[model samples]
Target: MEQLTTSLDVMFILLGAILVLFMHAGFAFLEVGTVQHKNQVNALVKIMTDLGVSTVAYFFIGYGVAYGVFLGFNLDGQLTQAMTEKSGYELVKFFFLMTFAAAIPAIVSGGIAERARFYPVLLATFLTVAFIYPFFEGMAWNGNLGMQSWLETSYGAPFHDFAGSIVVHAVGGWIALAAIIVLGSRTGRYDSNGNMRHVYPPSSIPFLALGAWILSVGWFGFNVMSAQAIEGIQGLVAMNSLMAMVGGIIAATFVGDKDPGFIHNGPLAGLVAICAGSDVVSPLGALVIGLVAGALFVKAFTWTQKNLKIDDVLGVWPLHGLCGVWGAIAVGIFGSTALGGLGGVSMMSQILGTLAGVAVALIGGFLVYILVDKLMGLRMSDEDQYEGADLSIHKIHANPPKEEF
Candidate 1:
């Protein structure tokens, strides 16, 4: 019976690992559909390569940094001991989490698309996945360095991210913000007078919608599987995620005046916001959170581009970073017993933890990008940007429909 339970747990997490891995396709397609046709191939290639490199970095370096598990160079020896100790579960857990960590680069890729140098971005992906992300992840999930203990002692609860609304989404968003700022806007994105002069619309709405659907589907595994054990599963988490998704849809639809881009990203914003507290909050609370997240995404994305003049191609910072911060804090509000939630969470803890994540992500991302810029440069030349990343880096256009005729 014990063996059977252990096997079930392994299977559950392994399934989750596969599902989250599939989310990479969603990320790739989302970027592909958003960037100009000339840069579409670059988007696809970058996501795939980033995932590949991230896998290597996480296996050899990141997992150790996060959980203190050293996978020595000898794979044969590690597997033998793992099988004997019935600790094969750890392998699947790493697979699941490695997907989450890899998402940092995936998120950043969208913001810096079209202008970032490919190999340099790959290096950033490796460093972010290997070191920066795991540092915060270790503190949040694994209690590394006693940060969790200190939070609990000080605020009456450890930082209460049931999943990774703050840990993963917020961290990724902030890091993307840092990268985008350092890399600057894509060439011709703004005017010589510091006015917003460019408007690069989506290349394929169908592909964009398809990517959102894939992410929505895979998110079930992303959130539910975080339970990591069948015994720990709760239907509330699934239901909350659903409510938040629809709430985001409704809110974005109305607020965005039916813009397809906003409509599609609305659900993503909600899902991002609900990830932290889906298990604890009521469906209604999740709905409110989703609605607010949707509005926030629309408002923030527009303001950043038009007012602040930040060129986040896919609005990753707003969809993930700001909404993630709200989700982290909302868990405190909605997770209270007074609010029809499972209790034992502290708002102060949530705030502090969320702030800590932002600080780490921003500082770490800036330093990594700045160091890379000085050493090897980060953005492509102006000539390369005008030529598009697909042709400049990949040596192919996404589609030569004009020439094919």
Candidate 2:
């Protein structure tokens, strides 16, 4: 039975890893559908390349940084040990978490699409996946540097992020914010008088909607598979995710005045918010969280474009960053026994942890991007931007003119 259990655990996590890995496709299609037609190929290419770069970075360096398990080029030895010890559970676990690590670049790709230089962005992905992200990931999940212990000792409870609300989503969003600031707004996105001189609408709504649906479906694995074992799975998590998704759709539909973009992204906002507390919060609490996140995304996305002039093309900061913070904090509020939850959470710990994540993401992202800019530059040339990334960077348009006979 023990051997059977180990094998089952390995199979479970492996499946979870594959499901979460599929989420990358959702990320690619989402970006492809959102960006202008000229930049669609660039979007697809970035997600794929970023995934490749992130995998290498995490396998070689970030896994060590986060969990003190450096691969150090010992592939055969590592696999042998992993197989003997619990049927390679650790290896499959790595695959699952590596997908999460890859998501940082995926999120940033959306915000900085169209105008970022290709190789520079790849460099950023390497540095971030191999270093910055793992630093906080170590703290939140692995108790690295005793941060989680200190939080629990001081606050009566450790921060509770069952999945990766603050660690992945918020960190990605804030890092994207830093990259956006460094890259500046896309050319002609705004006039010298701070007026909107150009508007880039979605190139394909069907593709966008398809991407959202894929993400929404795959998110169950992203959340539920964080359990890492079949016995740990809960129907509650699935139900709560569903409630939050629908709640977000309803709220964004009403608040965004039935905008298709908002409607599709609404469920994503909710899923992002619920990730931190899916296990603890009641379905109703999850719904409320979703509603708030949906409304917040619409409002903040519009406000940033108009007031702050941040050219976050997909509103990643609002959808991921702000909603992720809310998810972390909401765990304390709605996860308490007083609120029909399982309890054992602290608001102060949640706030502190969330703030720590934000600070690290912003500062680390800015420093990395700035250093990369100084070293090799980060933005496409004006001529390149006008020509579009598909043609300028990748040497191919998303849809080339038919060849002459």
Candidate 3:
């Protein structure tokens, strides 16, 4: 029986890891499709760099900080054996965490696209995934000081994020925000008159659509695979994820001015919004949350661009950060034992906890980005911006123009 449990846990974790891994391709295509032709290769480079950095950093330190050091489970006490006895599981956890590490920085690329220096972005990715993110993941999920106190004193159940709304998506969003502030807008994203210019991505609509579908598929593992134990409502998590995505698609497609972009972004928003409570929310609740998330995402993106003067190259802030916040709070509002038989801390308390998580993420992200900007210079030169990052940085030409003949 014990072996069976262990096998199931490993299988679920592996499945989730694979799902999250696929999101890389999703991000690659999505980002490349959303940016200008001049910046497409730069976007691809960032994604690929993030993949390498995530794998290495998470294995070395991030995994331990997130699930090992912070969990406070002494193998010496539990197994009466040396630390070597636990190295295998620890390694597995590290691989799992690499996906998350990769994801946060991938979010940042969209915010700083077209002008950010490649090496600087790489440095920022390392710092974020290795140190900045691990701190929050430790506190929130690893039963460290924050989760322990919340669970013991406030009756919270270990800061129940079935996947990672606040942990991964929101953290990534906050980092992206900071990077944008430091890196500034693209060369012509905002004009001398302080009016924002619309810079269309160089890729086709089909690319964005395909990327969205890939993300939707990957999200099943991102949410359900976190169940870790088959008995721990893995099926419920999967169901909620599916229902919310559908609801998000429906709302995104028809809710706005019938914009296809909004429709395309809906599933991503829905996935982010439902991430926090995927294991606990009922299918109906997930649907409602997804719909709200989809609508809110469209509104937030439009508002941020039109009113706030904040330019997100691929709309990462709306789809991930803002929607992630909504999903985190949704746990507080709809997380009831009776609703789906998966309850954690009280809804109100979870709300506070979610806010606290956001606070930590935002503050940490800001500080890290500021330091990176100061130390290494985050953005490229004006000449580089005009010439395009692909040519200036990589000395590569844009995709050859189609031949009319």
Among all candidates shown, the one with the greatest TM-score: 2
**Can you give the lDDT of residue 348 in candidate 2?**
95
Encode model 2's per-residue lDDT on 1-405: one tens digit a residue: 999998999999998899899999999999999999989999999999999999999989999899887765555576457656998888888899999999999999999998999999999999999999999999999999898999999999998999899999999999999999999999999999998788888999998998899899999999999999989999889988999899889999999999999999999999999999999999999999999999989999999999999999999999999999989999999999999999999999999999999999999999899999999999999999999999998899888899999
lDDT of 2: 0.93
* Candidate 2, poorest ten consecutive residues by summed lDDT: 71-80
Q: Which lDDT values do the candidates have, in the order given?
A: 0.92, 0.93, 0.78
Candidate 1 lDDT tens digits, 1-405? 899999999999999999999999999998988989889999999999999999999988888889887563435576456556655987788789999998999999988888999888999999999999999999999999998999999989999887799889999999999999999998888898889888999999988998898898999999999999989999999999999999999999999999999999999999999999999999999999999999999999999999888999999999999999999999999999999988989999999999999999999999999999988999899999999888889888887657554
TM-score, one value per model: 0.97, 0.98, 0.90
- Leading candidate by lDDT: 2
Error of 2 at 343 (Å): 0.2
Model 2: colliding residue pairs: none
* Local lDDT at 60 for model 3: 61
Residue 152, candidate 2: Cα error in Å is 0.8
User: Which stretches of candidate 3 lie above 4 Å from their native place?
Assistant: 69-87, 155-158, 337-342, 401-405
Better structure of 2 and 3 per lDDT: 2
